[model samples]
Target: MIRTVLSLIPAEYARLTPRFLAAVVAQAICQAIAYVLLVPVLKSLFGDDQAAAWAWVAPMLVAVVGVLVLGYLQSLLGLRIGVGMQADLQTRLGDQLNTLPLGWFEGRSAAALSHVVVDDVREVQGLVAYLLAKVIAGVVVPLGVAVGMLFVDWRIAVTMFVAAPVLFAVNSIAGRLYSWSDRRIHDAAVESDTRVVEFAQAQPVLRAFGAVGARNRALDAALTGQRSAIVRMVFTAVPSLFVFTILVQAAFLVLAYVAVERVTHGPLSAAAAVALVAVGSRFIEPLTQAAQLGTTLRSGAAAVDRIAGLLAEPALPESTTPVNPGAATVGFDTVSFGYETGKPVLEDISFTVPAGTTTAIVGPSGSGKSTLLRLVARYHDVTRGRIEVGGADVREQPTVTLLGQLALVSQQVYLFNRSVIENIRVGRPDATDEEVRRAAAAARVDEIAERLPDGWDTVVGEGGASLSGGERQRISIARALLKDAPVVLLDEATSALDPHSEAVVVRGVHQLSRGKTVLVVAHRLATIAHADQILFLDGGRILERGTHDELLTAGGRYADFWNERSRAAGWRLEPAPVG
Candidate 1:
């Protein structure tokens, strides 16, 4: 545990660690000295040596003062290191998250990460600020006193040495048990938190389906699991604590018995034996603290393990000498990918989009349409082949340079809780207000602003809940327009809009894609009928590749898909006769 904490401290604060530990050890030594002096002081006073008793008291007072001063310094250093360590851990986590592949952030994974950053970091911070100091003192003071006892009475010292190891072994076993329980409870808590967030976010759908309240089985199950885990933790903790406490008491009893037996056997005087018995509590006190602190230290160790695990997650390898792309073309050579091994999502897929040309991919649900666009953007590296943008392998190019070369408008749009104009400016942070307004006008976001209560300055709620779906899409389109990169990737950008809104958004998309390398995932076949090239994808492979007219004439899978969609387009509901 000590090694884990020292490894986590930031470089700037590393020098303070040795100083802090020295202070802790000094304080523990002084404490043991003051306690040991009690035995000699009592023995002298009982023997009627007033001068010798007073002599011992003087140095004992000084030792007590030393304990106080060193303790103060240790606390100051611990606090400084704790605060710095917390901030550094948070920063490191942020940096790691930035380098991780985007596909790793699934819902449960995100929730668990959030818990680690907030709760686990705080727990580990407490380890340095409080528990670490206590732990050092607990061990150091006890060992120092046992050695001190050797000078006063070897039999008592030997008894303490024998009991110390037994007590330590018991505490070690109990600590492991508590740590295991802590990790289980931590996982269950994260799972419960994920379910609660899901329940809240999905309220609209749940209510529409009449599955709200008691009918929401996922939420109920999650909460039940959390309760069960906590109950198990309590059950595990109580027995471990009970056994540890019993062992601590037994050790104290054995030490007291040895001191009394020494006086009976004529190896020690009554005054010395009584003093030994009195001073024995001081020896056992540190051990008792160890027993009491065991659970807390185990919990902190669990938190530290979580932090270490997150920091240990592998980041995508970045190129040492990054290269720049030479063109705006995109190509995939026999690409294959899967979220998990032995289960491929895209297999042996190959395609190329020439510079300044438009290619549309149409496929059934789960046919890897969206996955194709994600791969081009390098959201995840290819499993078997290479993806190139502008004739440069994406893996060889710096992430910033690769992302800067293209504009993406995915189906799932996320907007910050900021003013409408502010959200639109995210595409180009340094863009002038005039430039932002111009892009908004092109995307028809101006119409949305006009309807909002505060026009362009209106604060959109979280995820743009304040605006309609079509309004959010318009704002998204405005962002892409402002970016004005050489390449564009649209993942069904207009799928959520009405016909009128869709037409307006399409016009904005056309304006944005003019003279750019465009690759689109199109669900509406009619919308992509005029695309320069079309690829009919299904089951992770392209079954047909040609112009829309050529695919229709071939009378294959694309022809059948197009005919079915055309028939569905003209279908209408008829009024039924009254019963």
Candidate 2:
């Protein structure tokens, strides 16, 4: 357990560990020496030697003072190292998050990550700042006392050594019990946190459908489970602690019994026997403390294990020698991918978008249209083949170099709670105010801002909740326009908008896509009739490919799809015939 925790400490903080431990050791020795001095002082005083007793008293006082000073230094070091370690751990976790593939985030809840970063890390911080020092003293103090007793009385020293293993066995049993309970408690807490966050975020939908009561049942169950786990832990802990404490007292009594038996036998004086009994009492004090600290040490170990596991998660591999893209062309060579093994979402797909041209992916639902676009963006590496961006394999290019060449505007737009203009500036932080406004005007975002209470300065609520779907899409398009990348990828950006808003956003899309390498996932066939090339996909493979006129003339799946959509467009509701 000690080695596992030390492995996670950053090098800078690990360097102070030796100094911190030395102080704890030195303090434990002083405390043992002070207890040993009791034997000599009491024996001398009872023997009627005032000068010898005073001489022993002076050094005992010095040992006590040493203990006090060393303890102060130990605490100071622990706090300094603990605080530094907490910050470094959090920073490392953040860096790890940045390097991970986007798909990794898809499988985890935000609440689970939050609990690891906020709650588990805080527990580790408590370990070093407070619990570690006490736990160390509990160990070293008792061992020091046993060694010191050898010179004072060999019989008592032998008794303590004999009692050591028995005490350790009992303490170990208690620690194992507590560790089991702590793990369950931690799991329950994580579930409770996840349910609470889900409940809070889904309030609008829950209330709208009158399913709030249904959701409340899940939350209540989570809370109840957490409460039950905590109660079980407490019940299990008290009995173990009580058993360990009783065993410690029993060991002390055995030591006392030995001293009394020796006094009645030959060669041991009454005064020295009395002093030996006094020393025996001091020996049990640290032993009891160690048993009490068993739970704390186990808790710290559990927290460290959680932190190490997260840090050990693999990050996406990068090229040793990254290549820079030379053009804005995107090519897929027999690409195949899936979120899980043996469940391919795209299979044997091949397509290319020449520089300064547009390719529209048109398909039914679940046809891997958006997944194909994401492959070009390299959300996850291809499972079977290669994806090329700008004439170079995306895997061989630096992430920054690849992302810098393309701008993505998906249907689900997320905006931080900040001013309207500030959100647009996210595209290019170095862009001037005039440049931001220019893109906003091209996307018609200026029209939406004019009605906001604070105009361009108004804070768009979290996830742009204050804005309508069409309004958010306009801001997203404005962001893409500000980026001005050589290639643009749109994932059905205007599919859910009203006709008026669709027209407004389409004009912005045209401005953003003009003279760029474009890959668009089109839901409405009419929108992409003029695309340079169209791939009609179904069941994870492209079944038809050509220009709209060519596909219509061929009378394949694409032609049938177009005819169906054209007929749906002309349908209208009519009153039923009178009965």
What TM-score do all the candidates reach, one by one?
Answer: 0.95, 0.90
| Winning model by lDDT | 1
lDDT of 2 by residue, 305-407 (tens): 8888889988888777867688899999998899889999999998889999989988888999988988787788899989999899988988888889989
Model 1 lDDT per residue over 1-579, tens place: 899889999998889999999999999999989989989888887766767899899999999999999999999999999999999999999999898877677444667989889888998988998889889888888788889998888888888888888888878888888888888888888888988887876777889998777898888888898899889988988798898788878878888788788888866777777788778889888888877888788988998998998899889878777686788999999999998899999999888999999899988899999999988878889999999999999999888888898899988888999999999999999999999999999999998889889999999987887877778888999999999999999897665678998888888888899999999997676557978899999999999999999999999998898888889878899999999
| Residue 55 C-alpha lDDT in model 2 | 89
| Candidate 2: worst-modelled 10 consecutive residues by lDDT | 209-218
Model 2: runs farther than 4 Å from truth? 45-51, 213-215, 235-238, 264-278, 320-322, 553-579
lDDT of every predicted structure (CA atoms): 0.88, 0.87
Q: List clashing residue pairs in candidate 1.
A: none
